[model samples]
Target chain A: MDIKLDQILFQVLNFGVVFGAIVFLVYKPVIKVLDERAKKIHDADRAAEESLKEKDAIDELKKKEKVRAEKESAKMMEKAREQATELKKELTEKARAEIKLDKEKAMKSWELEKKGEHAAMRKEFVDAVYAVTEKVVGKAVDKKAHAGLIDKGLKELAQAM
Target chain B: MSAIQISISAEPIFHLGQFVVTNSMFTSVLVTALLIVFAVCANRAVTSTSKNSRFRILVEFIIESLQNLTTGVVGTGKRAHLFGPLIVSFFIFILVNNWAGLIPGVGSIGIWEHHGEENIFVPYFRAGTADLNMTIALALISVVLTQVFGYSFQKLKYFSKFINFSNPLNFFVGVLELVLEVAKIVSFAFRLFGNIFAGEVLLTVMTALVPLIIPMPFYGMELFVGFIQALVFSMLSLVFFNMATIGHGEEH
Candidate 1:
């Protein structure tokens, strides 16, 4: 095989130039574009993950708020029930007191009416007795006998007084 | 009828001052030009924001494959980035040159010259890898660059791989390693040159004997061989670069 220095040198130079041209013209740019694309994909993934985490956080907060609101509503309902019970009890007690007062007032009026009736009956009886005595004396005795009985009655009355 | 003669040497096509440009050199220049043109077009097509064009996609595929290969061989991260471009360039240049040889007129169409008693056919174009000069040149570049990468990576420790003055066994091992380094140049050059030159001669002989459908299978085989040789050369170069960059004790 023939080996020439000049030829070898030329071929080396040719390869070197070709290598440099390819590296500069094609390889570097292609690699750069690839790296940039990979970076973009990574960034997109990271952002999506961050958004997911935020969404989860917000959902948790919403859940907690819902629970708190339910509890507050339950407490308010209980308070309302308690207040209704108290008002019912107070109204019943007031009605019972009014009925008792009415009964007492009716009893006092009945007693007063009964007492007046009794007194009227007693007065009527005394009048009747006096009339009967007068009739008996007028029928059976004379005027003088009547006058002496009246004088005796007057002396007994003075001594007794 | 005269017998077909294949010369081992590249035939000189023309002269430029003292520099004699051969058929192989001419083919080399043409291949380089073609590659440069392709590179320019591919560069223009590739953009960071858009990835739509077929050309851009093709280039990206090639570059990505090369990146993976380099990363596989040289490990990942910065070292892969540093050597990836060169390995890719070598593969492309050699592959294109190898395939370019298969074109109809490249090895067939040439001028016939008169020797003392016979006609000597000299092709105007030869495959770049078929020439010993070209292969040797490429091997030299690969070996030298390996050394450069070695020094750049390991500094003074790179020399320790070639020489160890501490012990007898270590020194002997260093010497063996040094011999192997030189042998690598021979191995690289001959492997490429032998494969491509054999393919060229095989095609030439087949065409002479049958000149018909007989050479079709051989042509296909040559195409496969060419591609394989290119891959082999670049892979070996990548291996060498990887070896050079790491410490001798480091795992491959």
Candidate 2:
């Protein structure tokens, strides 16, 4: 094969021009866009992943909060129940004490009334005896021995009647 | 001349236009067509959720590897996006050209001829990178692109890299930079030419020497060497590009 310098040079120049033109016009620009796109895609993917992770964290936190809230609510309910039970017990005990006190007061008042009535009756009986004795004694005697003898006779007569 | 030797030596293939189309050319055309078809089909068949089919996987692997190499060396900022496609195309083209050499029809199934007692085999397809002219052209494009990007990116600074006249020392540095640029072209051309030519020669010699089992291992090695050489050439170009774009302060 015969080697030609001109032919070789022409071929080289031609190849260079073809490749250079394509690179300048199409390849380089396209690659640049693609690269930018890749960077954007990578950034977006990272953001999406971070958001997903954040969402998971939020979900977990919500779950924990819910559980905590439930526990707190339960504790409050139990406390309220305990207070109510305690209050109910106190009120019931107070009412029972008041009923027992009223019962004692009523019994004491009834006894006082009975005693007063009995005393009054006794006083009346005494008055009647005095009047009767006084009348018997007035007709006779002003002496102490005479009065004593008359009082004794009247007491015996009253008792026999 | 023996009849058996004449039969082996005198097979002539057809021609197309000015270019003599032989079996090697046929194989190369086939390979090129296959690549185009693959690109088209893969583009059409792409889906979001589906795993890439076998062919698509292979193509994506090739493209992604190229992209990764570019990004790794040049960093993901500045001109990586700009130079990625150029670098990828360079790699793919050279890789295809280099791999084409290993096909059965390459350097074989050629137009055979007679020259007295010796046989002359004219190959239909010369491995594109193996040709000095082709490699030189590719090198020029790579180096020129480096300059273009540097100019566009740094503008006045890029020009000042070789045209500084502020002081004697600066002038001398400028001259040195100019000299380095020229040297870059030479180095690029020679590096690719030498590696590819050597690989071709090695394959040829190996085939001629053993013709049988020995060539198989060398073929495998040649494939590996071709891949490495292509990688090295492209990587070196990328490094040069990175260096150029980064300006004179940073080491490559």
Candidate 3:
């Protein structure tokens, strides 16, 4: 066996040099890149998870907003319906009052006309009676006293009718 | 017919001052250079974000696969990161060295030296792991790092595993374990060196015996052995590291 101390030492030193070269030149840098890529992937996954949670929260908010708007709209419709009913009631009352006032005024004007027509008929009857008397019983009659008596009888007949 | 010259040890190709540069050492240096070049290129490719190449993709696939294997054995987080590159480097180093023997010119192409009446064949390149020095170095590195990991993880508790005096039986077991740690180092060195060296010898002999179409199967077998040995070495190191951190009958 050719075992020599110096050669062994030299070989060991040679291998040691090789180990150092490989570690520095190859291993460390490659491992660094792998770690970086892994970290980046992990960060991307975490970001995606966060975005998903945010989207869920926004969806929940949207649902609540829609419900709130629906409730508000329903309340507005109810209020509008109440106002319409009130307006219809108020308008009906005013129209009824106007119709009643018009009916009363028409009744008053018809009654006044009937009174004027009765007065004119009475005067005409009085004038016609005086002419007839003059024709039938001619000469020596008292005009004032007979007229007064006929007028009183006609007034009594008009009041009874 | 020329006899097949198989040597259990690496042949010295040249000498610089007192330092002897063996063929195995020469190949190791070459492998190291190639690995460094590949690393520099890979570093450039990996660090850049503009374009992708198939070479880069294949390298990444292999690296990620090795990392995953380390993760499975050692568990992830920080420990895997620390152990992965070392384990991969071991595999790559041993694998390249093992396969280097299979190259056509590595064991065959050489110079003839006159030693008196006979000539000796001394190859310029030999498989690195086939040498005892290289394997022992690897084994020593593994064990030392294992101890370091144990201490770093368990602190004071790690030493108690080797030097426990709570009971006689426990003490004996501790001593046995300590010896076993040394045994582990020998085991690591021999297992790698034996397999790679034996394969080289077997190939040389098979070629010498036939010198024709028969050595092809042995070459294929060597390829498989080369890969298996590399895997075994790296995997064992990783397990030892894990065991050291967890330390004796303790749950991880």
Candidate 4:
């Protein structure tokens, strides 16, 4: 085959044009899109990772708050128990003191009643004896002298009974 | 039926001033226009908002595959990106041109012209790589671009690869290397041209022998050969480029 210099030159120039057009039209634009897609994916992954970390931190804070609340409530319950015990003991002691006072008042009233009864009994006995002596020996003794001796004897007898 | 007539050179179809436009050149121009149109459409599809269409996906797939093929040889860096389009262009350009002649009407539909007593047929389109001129041009471009890449990477130090003068044996080896570089042009041109032209001749002969079902297998073979030649040309170019652009003493 005959190799023509002109034809070769023509081809070389033709290829140069084709190469330039293809680069401008196809290669550059496609590569840019691909690069942009890759960048978007990378950014999305990073955002997901950061959000996950934030969620973890929030979860940790919630856990700490719950634990602290539980501890505070427990302390309040313990304090409530202590106060309840103190109230119960104070009420018991106050009730015992009131009962003791009531018993002393009842004892004092019973002794007064017993003293009145005894006096009554002594008077009755003196009257009975005076009547019997009068019937046996009429108007033998003075009433005032006998009255004083009889009162003295009756008081001793009543005290002895 | 008449005997098969195969010409070694592509027949001249028309003239432009003093310049002769051969059939292969016309077909090359057609291939160029087709590629440009395809690129524009692909570019439009990619830049548009709705790129999930099947056509767009296909376009993207093709470009990605070409990009992957390129990066495999040149590795992923500024150099790979820089040289990727040019290398892929070689594959597209050669492959389409190689297949263009195999079309039904391309070589068969032609005008008969008088040359003395006999009439010679002049076709309107021939495979671009079937022409020796086109292959030589492509080879020269590949080799020359390799040198340019080498210079860009190594500055003046790249010449040492073929011009060493330190010792007698080293000088001889350097001279041999320089000769090999020049020989590469001849080898590249002949190899592609020989394969395509022979395939053309073979198909023509086969069609003449049996016009119907006999040449079908030959057509399939030609298609495979076309793809293979395209791959070989582009891959060799890529290898040379890779070799040239690396540091002088650095291992690949």
Writing each residue's lDDT as its tens digit, candidate 3 over B1-252 gives 797788889999999999999999999998888888878888888878977788778677767878888999988867797789888888888898899989999988889999899899999999999999999999999999999999999898998978989999989988998999999999999999999999998988888889899999999999999999999999999998888888567753
Per-residue lDDT over A14-127 for candidate 3, one digit per residue giving the tens place of the 0 to 100 score: 888778777787777666766686799999999999999999999999999999999999999999999999999999999999999999999899899888888899788877
List per-prediction Cα lDDT, in the order shown.
Answer: 0.88, 0.67, 0.88, 0.87
Q: Rank the candidates by TM-score, best first.
A: 1, 4, 3, 2
Per-residue lDDT of A84 in model 1: 91
| Residue runs of model 2 more than 4 Å from their true location after superposition | A1-161, B1-34, B47-51, B114-119, B166-173, B250-252
* Chain A TM-score of each candidate structure, as shown: 0.45, 0.48, 0.51, 0.47
Q: Which tens-of-lDDT digit does each residue in A1-161 have in candidate 4?
A: 77889999999998987887778888788888878987999999999999999999999999999999999999999999999999899988998988888887887887787777766776677667777777777865566878888878777876897
Off by over 4 Å in 3: A40-161, B247-249
Tens-place lDDT digits, model 2, residues A4-91: 3443454455444434543554444444545676899999999999999999999999999999999999999999999999999999
What value does the lDDT take at residue B228 in candidate 1? 95
Q: List the residue pairs that clash in candidate 1.
A: none
Put down candidate 1 lDDT per residue, A12-83, tens digits, no spaces: 999988999889999999988889889999999999999999999999999999999999999999999999
**TM (B chain), model 2:** 0.81
In the order shown, the candidates' Cα RMSDs to the true structure are 10.6, 9.9, 8.2, 7.3
Q: Which one wins on DockQ?
A: 1
Residue B161 accuracy (lDDT) in model 4: 74
Q: Compare candidates 2 and 3 on DockQ and give the better one.
A: 3
Model 4 TM-score on a 0 to 1 scale: 0.75
